[model samples]
Target chain A: MPDAGPPGRRPRAAPAGRAASLRRQLFFWLLPVAGVALFVSALADYLVARDAASQAHDQGLLDAATTYAERVQLSPQGVPRDMPAVAQRMLLAEPDDRVFFRLVDANGIVAAGGAGLPDDLPDGSAEAPAFFDLGEGQQRLRGVAMRFEAGGRPFRLAVATTTRKRDRLMAEVLLGMAVPEALVFMMTGLLLAFGIRRGLAPIAPLRREIARRSHSDLDPLDMAPVPEEIRPVVAEINDLFARLDRALRAQRDFVADAAHQLRTPVAGLLAQVEAAERAAAARPLGAAELAGVAATARRLSRLVAQLLALARAEPGAPLPMEDLDLAEVVREGAEEWLPRAFAHDVDIQFDLARTPLTGSRIALREMLANLVDNAMRHGGPGGRIRIGCHPADGEARIVVEDAGPGIAPGDRERVLERFCRLPGAHPDGSGLGLAIVRAVVARHGGDIRLGESALGGLAVDIRLPAPAP
Target chain B: MRDARLLLIEDDQALADGLSRSLRQDGCQVAAAVTAAEAKALVGSRAFDVIVLDLGLPDGDGREVLAHLQQLGKDTPVLVLSARDGLDERVGLLDLGADDYVVKPAAVDEIRARVRAMLRRRRARTGQTVTLGRLTLDPQARRAYVDAEPLTLTARELAALEFLAARADRIVTKDDLLAGLYGGDRDVSENAVEKLISRIRARVEPAGVQLRVVRGLGYYLQTGDA
Candidate 1:
């Protein structure tokens, strides 16, 4: 049994390898997926911004190359004239960057302006100039090269600028796109953690309701606040509590009934002993008075024994089952009760057969004993009591019938209850015999029926399941 | 066996006192102990012919006393008395070397009779004659007498009488008598035993003895006034 800890204390930790926190599991499952999604989208945004920034910077280089190309004057022999220094300075003016230009003849000579400019011509016509990078490290520049014809000879013009402005623009786009996305990602993770905790909040009240209850408080838990997913679980717990409550009440009532039943015989025994003592003071106690005391003691002893048998036969009691022949159990019972039958002037006959079953020997013996006892009590003097055992319809059947007054059909069911004696019952009966029989029968998963016998008395028909073939 | 020494270890004060008084009246010297410790002390100090031990005791279990007696190499028979009447408990106690087990709430007469039976079994090699009231049987001679007068009986009748007399207070089944008299002879029916009992009853009844028939069981011999 799991320990139900004391009130106001946290429940003990679950056994190793079984601990599961739903809140942590949900957060763990959700947060990483959200983080990866945010990361992929942010990376795409950075790439798009970088592409747009480079396109704008390359367009400015193309404009500068076109302006420098217009300034060049070429002789008919295809020798390009150098640009005026003032005009060159005006075209290359810029802040935070240095600009360079070159006009090269088709022979690949350094025609004008700064040397070492890349002269890679565009694959398309001169109207569609191509952009390229030149130099290394901090001197890296973006340049565009184009071809033009003067006097029917091809000449190339190149313009390049240091890349500081383009680098600054890319950095701006990265800062603008990544910072807010990261904030949103962190915010979503926090919300997910909080949401999971709130989603699982209903379990707290259920736990508290259970922990706050006293041991004897077996009331069903209130289900209004329970979540839909766990309602079935709570309902099951409530069902168990209801069963426990019923069993507890039955136990309490049985104890009270037993006490009362025990008191009657004990009180009689004490009274008889006191009377005998008083009588002895006058003279020796008479044999009749002595017999009275003995009778009371015997009744008390029988009651105690019956009560023990009933307790042992109660449901959930440990029963040690073995393969046994029911006919043998019946025979033993008949032999044990034969003396009583003789005293009552009742004739007992047996029709025993080998009826094999799996059952507790002691309990089955007790059951048969009670049946015979009941038969004799009601069968009266000179009554014929018939006991039969055999296998019928895949079950071991035992029938005990008497030739005396039988119970009415309506009252048959009521007599199986503990201490439910019929009106005007024999004074000697403790009213527990049939109840013990019923309990034993029920424990063995057998069925019992009380009906009018062919002999004119009650017939207790018992059917116990036979062992599997 | 008249003055056999007996020890009774029971925790209930009133029960112990009453039982001891009754056993003493039955012609035995009975010593009483209220706890396991006291029982062990008494067992170590003296020899008892029989011991009636209750399983439940205040200081310890009655089994401890049984174990203690075993350690001392005492072979005195122990009759266990307990409220636990389960078959397993009875078998376990007997396996633990107890001579017998009787459930509690038992009649004092029953206990006395069991103690006497144990004593008789211990000395059974002598084959002592059994006497109940005026009816006595001399098994060695295959004879029975009432008031010291021998009654004429055949071999089968004598055997049946002796069997019933030996188990006087208990009801003997017809099968038990058949086995005792005929010893697996299938030709002899139970009806033959019934006729034999009637013949014995006719002779014994005039001598103030009864060969009582318990219907559906077997027979019991009631010696007059016993």
Candidate 2:
């Protein structure tokens, strides 16, 4: 299996809270829009209401002035005759409302009797009647002022009404417009929140469904019910699962096939032992004859043992993982096989590095054992064997070389296959030693290469990945 | 003369008969059973001096016999013979009270040697020092005396010598020695082992005991005149 990118250093996830998040985005864009619209509408509503109230009050004042102008027979001075009667007629008309009027000669004088009017009016200026409150809290009055040129003299007229009436009308107009707008804004915000949450609801179920799955189940989730926007993510998940399931199935089959194939030879060895036993029992055995039967038994026994060892070294073998000291394992393995090398007059040299391997110690040791055994077995008698380990390519490297007759370049890969032995090899071997070495190395995810050694024999180099952080 | 009754439990008939003949020639009364069930029945019916048990049977595992014998507290020595040489399998058989174990494809003589060793261990009631030729060893005392002189040896060396002496004159391979000594892990180096042997030889060979190295095979301990 390939190493997944260094675990536990995964990237942090982004925020997934949709409502508050969406509201924040909307607030930035919509708050300014809502504020500008509210400001413009409020200004327009105030202007229209104020202008209409002033215009209606001005019309009443003008009518009163026209009546007075007609009543006056324009006595040589152009002063009003019966001014009090005319004022009384205008002010007390219909209701007992207040009204004030003043007629001025060519000189600038007080034209209107409305409260808070300036004493001196600017010459040649046209000022329309305007409204304002007169008192503080209670008894406040709303009134209007009007200026006109009547009988060729500067004159002004003013009218007054209590603010309670004007305020009631203005309040009704604003409430009618503002209240509905506020209600619609609140309702729209609520609906937006609900819709956003509903849209993201499927993600939680998808996460839960994924979390509930067994490790062996890599089937893709059904995307038919999901939102259209999420279909791509779902499809990708299913594709990954499909690939993972296929890989796991292939690995399982490889293991099963290897186990079944290796058992047959062992069964055959058992049968042969029984046959040899009967052969010895049926007749008196001579020295050479007895030796032949015993040697055959020994050969069969060796073959069966090697077969099991080779199977154990296969990538399919269930190797338990642990932290192992490479130096210790190499030193120990070399020491264990020292006697056999000496018996064959071969000098075995060791130069091991102090590195750690994160893998199965048994499988690693078995791999090394097979390599050393192969070197001694194929390397002619009295040849020197050298073993060493060091760090290479972010992994640990193990090398075993011998001075015996090296393998041909063409035969290097073939020797790694099961039951493939070199011609003129030792008669006692099962031809599975190198094959076992290859299998063990493969199981560790390590690569092994065979080539000419410094000792003029075969050199086996193995490399395994470094321990995980 | 004591009749050494040996119970042979092998599933294969041809192998059982051949093994029985070899045992009989060695003056053992061979009681052959083809399965663990038959062996269990025969064991209940008669008393044998030693048992040669095979692991794989059509009916059940040979370890069952060992578990059964252990439960019954029967001390009759048992020598395990199986075709499976897996490290775990060997440890399991021995741990289950089998006195000895030998993987299959074994010579008749090696099997006989293992049977004799089982019988010898059983016959030696006191578990005292055993002197064969010039080599003297006391397994219980954890010491070795070569040619009447005391010698200091490592624990592994002493165990190795004991194993070699117990089955002398037979060719034991490196794998066999490894299985016997270090059953836990087989990663021991050959050179380091050779050093231990050389050390062992330096101490013992100074006297008269000879430990000869068999080329391309294993070491043999020769006690008599070279």
Candidate 3:
């Protein structure tokens, strides 16, 4: 069994600072609001309870004043009589407070009961009474004063009580409102904390899934279980993984193809060398045999150079690019091939225009060399080859045409693949020329087309995207 | 080139042995070095007609040897022999004072031709005549002679003969011939070059100078019997 090699090192996630917890954040935010609600409700309850307690106590004081007024028989000078002792005891019967009463004639003098009551009572009518508060500290009182006519004479009655009962009732009301509200506020906080944790629970499994995955695992994450809000993010990551998978596969395929291509020429060269050695042991090798060895070695060298060019031209390969004229590249490439063209008696012509573009000079040169080489190989001896470069429609167009048997439309596409040599092709041909041209075109964001040339041969038309003006 | 001295710096033992043997057969005295240290020592101690320096060496990069050559102020033409086929590396080596750059796995014939071309260019600068076997060309005076006898030739014929003689024992293509003859002028057809080559062949063939045509390729000039 083949080893899968060492497991891919786990990707180290970015270092995280002390992150804020969503649950804690929610709880902290709700605490102050809950507390404010409890305080406001307690204050309202205290206000309402105090009002009711004071109203009831004042009513008792008014009743006691009215009773004293009714029971009193006015003397000839119209002085009011004190209340009866049993009546007084009944009026003062508050367990949590002390009560007092007084009677006064029209002259504003106290005539009975407690003499220390305030004489500054508001004016009162026989049918209506007035309420007032008097004194300070332990002697503080809520009082009611009333005026009445007995035996056709007028008098004023006053009653007062301490505030202890009102205060005690208010305290009970405040505690009644605050305790339950506080309990409910605390319960709400606990529920909020629980809800926040539950809402964020799905994220943990997602993180664990990612952390546990190997680098080679480029499969997409399951989006069905992902939260709807985070689904788009996961989908984006899946898209990235798909792209990476494709690039990795392409690289692996290229490496394999290059190795396979290299093997054939190297083996041939080695065989030729061995044969030459065996022959040389018997006699000096003839020039023909020596030429055969040299040709094999040259073929191997050409293959190696082509493989390097293809690797450099592969898409996504990093290249140092510069602004250069396509015409210059075409000229240099044509010059390099002029010797071979002359050797074949091929009339090679170039009509170069200053087509400006941003590209790797080496890659462009290699691309041109391959195109010209392909033309020379197929164009045959005593044929013509035309190379042209021009700028058109915001692109740099380069065309290489040869005068030979042009490729059929159906077979043109296949020839661009690595090692796809056409039947009856030259034995020395490596079949990587068109593939390299395609890769270089693809790398430069360019398009290549094959068509029948007017010169009665195959024409390669390439258009590369130009740099923006 | 029979008396020319060459220094070959390469790490691969088999390749060095084979290349040195081929060069020696070509009548060049070759000194082989397997490391940069040896190469530097040889370059400093002896004056060579040409240095074939490999970029990859066991002791250090071949550029160190190039730097050493420059430090010694030696004007001997240095030809870079490397496995790197990248244009940038070739341009960089040339910029570093290398006279020529040839990718490895090249034929010994091509290497010899490049070395000859480099030496020819050097000799041309010194106004020396180029000789290939029985044929010798005085390029400065635009004249050719077969065994001390001046050959009557037209100016274009002499230029063509000089071009072929300068690159003797190598292929010369029609386009190269036309470009060499006329520079960037394309008005001259390839038929004209063929006619010119045939005429020159007829004129020089009687003097032991053979102008051979490699069908579907180019022409080759041979000075002596093959």
What proportion of the true contacts does each candidate reproduce? 0.28, 0.12, 0.16
TM for candidate 2 is 0.49
lDDT of 3 by residue, A11-74 (tens): 4455344467555777789778877877787778778777888888777777777766666765
Error of 3 at A135 (Å): 19
In order of lDDT, best first, we have: 1, 3, 2
lDDT of 1 by residue, B74-169 (tens): 888899999877777766777778987777878887677777766654433235566655666787887878879987888888777777766654
Each prediction's interface RMSD?
3.6, 8.3, 7.5
Compute the lDDT of residue A18 as modeled in candidate 1: 84
CAPRI-style docking class of model 1 based on DockQ: acceptable
Per-residue CA lDDT of candidate 2, range A1-469, in tens?
Answer: 5543342443335656533564457555665666567668776977798778656654655556555544544456654443555655764364434444444445554332334433443222234344444554435544444455556665544444444445565677777768776776666566656665676777778867876666776877988777888889889989999988887886676456555644655455556556657767987645765565556556666665666666666545666676777766775454345546655766677776677888766566667777888888878687778888887767988889988788899999998887676898876666677877888778778888999898889999888887853
**lDDT, candidate 3, residue A60?**
75
Best by DockQ: 1
lDDT of 3 by residue, B1-226 (tens): 6768999998888788888998888888999899999989998899898888889998889999988998999888998888876666767787779987776766676677677766765664455787655667798888888889897889999888887876664557788898899894789988999999999988877766767775445676643321
The positional error of residue A347 in candidate 1, measured at the CA in angstroms, is 4.3
Cα deviation in Å at residue A207, candidate 3? 4.0
Whichever of 2 and 3 has more TM-score, that candidate is 3
Give, for candidate 3 chain A, the lowest lDDT window spanning 10 residues. Answer: A1-10
